[model samples]
Target: MESKRVLITGAAGFLGSHLCDLFIKKGYEVVGMDNLITGDLSNIAHLFKLKNFEFYNHDVSKFVHISGKLDYILHFASPASPIDYLKIPIQTLKVGSLGIHNLLGLAKSKNARILIASTSEVYGDPSVNPQPESYWGNVNPVGPRGVYDEAKRFQEAITMAYHTFHGLETRIVRIFNTYGPRMRLNDGRVLPAFIGQALRGEDLTIFGDGSQTRSFCYVEDLIEGIYKLLLSDYAFPVNIGNPDEITIGQFAEEIIELTGTDQKVVYKDLPQDDPKQRRPDILKAKELLNWEPKITRAEGLKLTYEYFKSLTKEQLEKIDHKDFSEFTR
Candidate 1:
């Protein structure tokens, strides 16, 4: 009997690699693909020896080629971090537009159920607290962060188009701030950035006076929700995240306690269009998917800090970053 096959884009990334492990555990033959533009190979390198897992070093914004049957497709290829997206804004837009189109075409060709990884950035700086899936969003299409924000907005728009126009099988999960192992320490995300500074014996830099709030979901909790959403019949975007929200200043303090760091938070000017508050309203997710995050913040933070602690001195000292100036044109 042939096993079911799943295709995962951005398989080398923190989230996508974790999805690969979950699907493989569920008896699927996993086909992993990444451009490595923002994903790290080390995240998925452990699966190289598995007979059922295969990988391709191909960028999805270009032509995507895959052989054989594919039952599912998870499109997660994009410069997700602010640093990466801001550095290569063009690529970020391309992946959300061109990359998604390519994967949707492939899904149609293979008759596979497709899931697109959307983000809370689609909400931009929301007027509502705990944003619901129905909100139209308040976004600055011309802001510095617009490249990534508008790209994701377009991704969701087009994805819904495919669902309504072509009647394609699809799922969308608008993930919130997720933290766990395999996350790059220098990605400029709040968790890793704070932890990196502490580990480097520097003050924890908090942009925007550290009052802006964000809700975080553990990677495993997010993966579980996504997996269930993929198998379910829901077609619209679903919000999957921990509802336990905290202010950046408060979170920095938590990290200090967790890592046993003596450093304190330092404020800086917030970047343009940075969301002042973001926490997903998961009621729809609750009623529809029968899912909610089970991991407590304390437990999750302890686990994440341990993972950061496990890195070598060099890896901890500096994280991988790319020079995309040559390709941005």
Candidate 2:
């Protein structure tokens, strides 16, 4: 009777950290890795005391070397947010390509199943309404968001190669917008951004008239989907997200209501290549993994708002005001 071991890259990130919790709770010996470029150690700090948990302060894009058997490799490392990828586009690209290369190699060496976290961004400005896994996507390769988008595309390409050529077991999950407790209030994603502004008693800024739409999945539901996918026999991609759709303007109102903040909505110009709509067609996930998001927006939002409220005064004040410049290459 031996415990399973899992290597979770970006284990300090909001999503990655949550995976660590889920795996550990399910009786797995977890090895967490992160460069902390955009991850905060505090997210995974509590797990440090667990006997079965360990962490590596290394960036996977550069090199990844882990000792002992690795039963699973969850490649969750990357600067996932626009602000993060914009500031460190090169790093994002490298992690998605080189970092994934390293992990695939590790998985092959250990004969372990690997799951790489892809994004809905792959279905860039998607021509299809609720993007099915079959949609090829409508992406501008040189656009501002292409760094993250293309990197993920490359990651998926190479991952499938290993599965096809090298015969390594693999999984890919196109994650939609996920929000929860450990979310950085300044990650520049709509959820945290709205929460931060409302917490600080500032007007919620809506870019591009807030007409653009996004679908949000609760973190717990997303983690469950990932977990089921890993153990399943599927090798292709699966969309893991809540299909409930809402516009930025409408979502802003929801946040204001949940937080009891009197803040009004303000508008700003939309950034280049921003998706007008994003909702996952999870029919494949539902059929294959028997998964669909269970957390309603109201329940999830209230929980997330309380988490934001529990932040320290200084953390609450740490607003990200860095002006982002697009990556042209």
Top TM-score hit: 1
lDDT of 1 by residue, 183-294 (tens): 8887889998888888887999999988899999999999999999999999999999998999999999998888887996788899888999999999999999899999
Provide the clash count, candidate 1. Answer: 0
RMSD of each: 1.2, 2.5
> Looking at candidate 2, what is the lDDT of residue 152?
98
Which run of 10 residues does model 2 get worst, by summed lDDT?
Answer: 319-328
Worst 10 contiguous positions by lDDT, candidate 1: 316-325
Q: Tell me the lDDT of model 1 at 23.
A: 94
User: Per-residue lDDT of 221-256 in model 2, one digit per residue for the tens?
Assistant: 999999999999999999999999999999999989
Candidate 2 lDDT (Cα, whole model)?
0.91
Assess each prediction's global lDDT (C-alpha) against the native: 0.91, 0.91
Clashes of each: 0, 0
